[model samples]
Target: MLVPMPSEPSGQTPPASSLPGPSLPTPLPAIAALPAYVPGARGDAAVPPIKLSSNESPDGPLPSVTAALADAGGLIHRYPDMAASELTARIAAHIGREPAHVVAGAGSVAVLAHLLQAYAGEGDEVLFAWRSFEAYPILTRIAGATPVTVPLTADARHDVEAMAAAVTDRTRVAMLCSPNNPTGPALTTAEFEAFMAAVPTRVLVILDEAYLEYVTDPDVVDGPAALDRHPNLVLLRTFSKAYGLASLRVGYAVGPEALIAPVRACVTPFSVSGPAQSAAIASLEAGDELVERAHTVVAERERVLAALRADGWSIPDSQGNFVWLAVGEDTGALVAHLGGQQPSILVRPFAGEGVRVTVGSPRENDALLAALARWQGRTG
Candidate 1:
């Protein structure tokens, strides 16, 4: 049986009572308007691709760590140590700091988030360079703090002088991501010292060295070296980049116990799992064998730079395990063109025409070169 209603309703709007539950919270227009985040493409059968979109180590986790993961299989039944004390002790010893001075988290990101939550609050300003790490601003806003963004220089390097000038009395945190994401240029020791000197001590400065291992520059600021001079300087490093433990999600910070203590309180209990802890510890013990990979990536990065330059592509001085290809206005077309290649290499393309190509194994590097060469030939 069919019940028919009038094709043209007898002239009235539905009563307000007919609406579903309460209306959504009055959203922050800025946040509500933000576009959805897009992760890099994965195994798309239609697109034969090599996913280099994220700045991940092309060489996977160390062999010893893999063995540790397998050995830790049975232990998954039990919860990870809530304190993560053993992993903290091991990491602290490796970094030449006391365990109390170290705080491990899911990744360096969790440490950064906790730091923001502990320090910056409503009406506080959090400063960072534009396009440094996208998460900085998002985290700041999430913590009810104002984000003070400073533009990078023409070469895409952090203009430390400009960043220092942007600081205000309300500024609670300042972050510097050296060998910065996307651009890959790091801050010189002198630049960091100057930036620190210019900044007031009340405000904390976090130097994110996520890609520290891939850097070969002698001038780059060593995390431990600056620890003594600046009490507020917190250096954040991760095992994800060179050690290839991204899946394990283990990272720690080296800083004054005052700051570290509050940040630690913000961390959720047992955030880092037992297998991750075992794998991270194993990776740290492996040491030099793991670090040697950085050297290989650096060499490959140079080759990629030269080949791109020869092909008339403008690239930046990448100190990380990745290189940046800036195609200016043609970003979309360029990405589509490059992504369309056979045994295709995918890259992290930014909103504007900047793409980051992670350094891969020798064979993978050669494949990327071939693709870039073909793209250049067609686009030039």
Candidate 2:
């Protein structure tokens, strides 16, 4: 009755296998079903690689943004503005919206997640196009809501009519990703307006314009301009892509004050760091310079697309800062071949779907074209 637990031998600890394991709680069943969001591969560090992955700006953050970040560095000990007041005001001013109608989050993804959390839950459904942003279904499931997806058209564009037809009584949110990821064609204004007419007013519509800055197409849906007409509409914009603040993570949503209030409530307190807010405000101030840089990327995108088409690749008309190559089952082989090169080229591959190549600097773009030429030769 008084026996003590046996002690370990001198200078030796008991085997980890013999220890009593900690009990852990089980996760939601839906979590296991969720697919992982695979980011683009980062090539080896020994050699400098031509990285055209992640749709990031070839030229990093703007000069003004960098300067603001440097100035904000001294405030590292302090917590960020919980309301993100200054940045919110700047965004509202930039978009000609009221401050009360705007809410800022770490990034557009975070803002979108908050929106889902606020409006969707068990028994509700969130709708979006298939093969759009990979995060859509993941975030929808995380909110304990059912994800209803409509397939993209054969041209790799949003089948708006199909998406609108798929909406049901359970549908609480519908997301439209203009200039959709991996498949770069944007949703036209007429297509969007027709879809909006078909959808019920109760269902919230989110227009994700993350690549709006790089869009050269005149007919693409302009989210902010249409916000006045669709009270249920929410416009999502990010500083990550065109503003080149991917590392800092700042994005905003503009919508009706009533809906925005709930989205703001769902955001984690002080999640938007001080430096990020400062950089975003600085980025807003440098609007002209940002526009110039975006134009540069758009020009390069056209050049790359033209070259690819001339080389027998049937690419969609991309309005975003990237191009999509529908390589079908050859995705893995093409990705490997590109990565296996001396100065490897990194592009986002969607297994059996296609590859997304970011518009890089002139030299980097040339390198990518050269790599494609070599691959074509080998495959033929």
Best by lDDT: 2
What is the per-residue lDDT of model 1 for residues 1-380, given as tens digits with 9 covering 90 to 100?
Answer: 56554354578766567644557688886466544555566658885578788778878777888899999988999999887899899988988888999999999988899899899989999999988777787788878888999988888889999999999999999999999887889999999999999999999999999998888889999888799889998989888889888878988888989879999999989999999999988988999988788888888889888888887877778889888887767778778876777776788788675777888878888888888787777766
Q: How many pairs of residues collide in model 1?
A: 0
lDDT accuracy of residue 188 in candidate 1: 90
TM-score of each: 0.91, 0.96
Question: Where does candidate 1 have its weakest 10-residue lDDT segment?
Answer: 1-10
Q: Residue 95, candidate 2: how far off, in angstroms?
A: 0.3
Quality of model 1 by C-alpha lDDT: 0.85
Model 1 alpha-carbon miss at residue 3, Å:
26
**Native-referenced Cα lDDT, model 2:** 0.92
Report every candidate's CA lDDT.
0.85, 0.92
Residue-level lDDT for 376 in candidate 2: 89
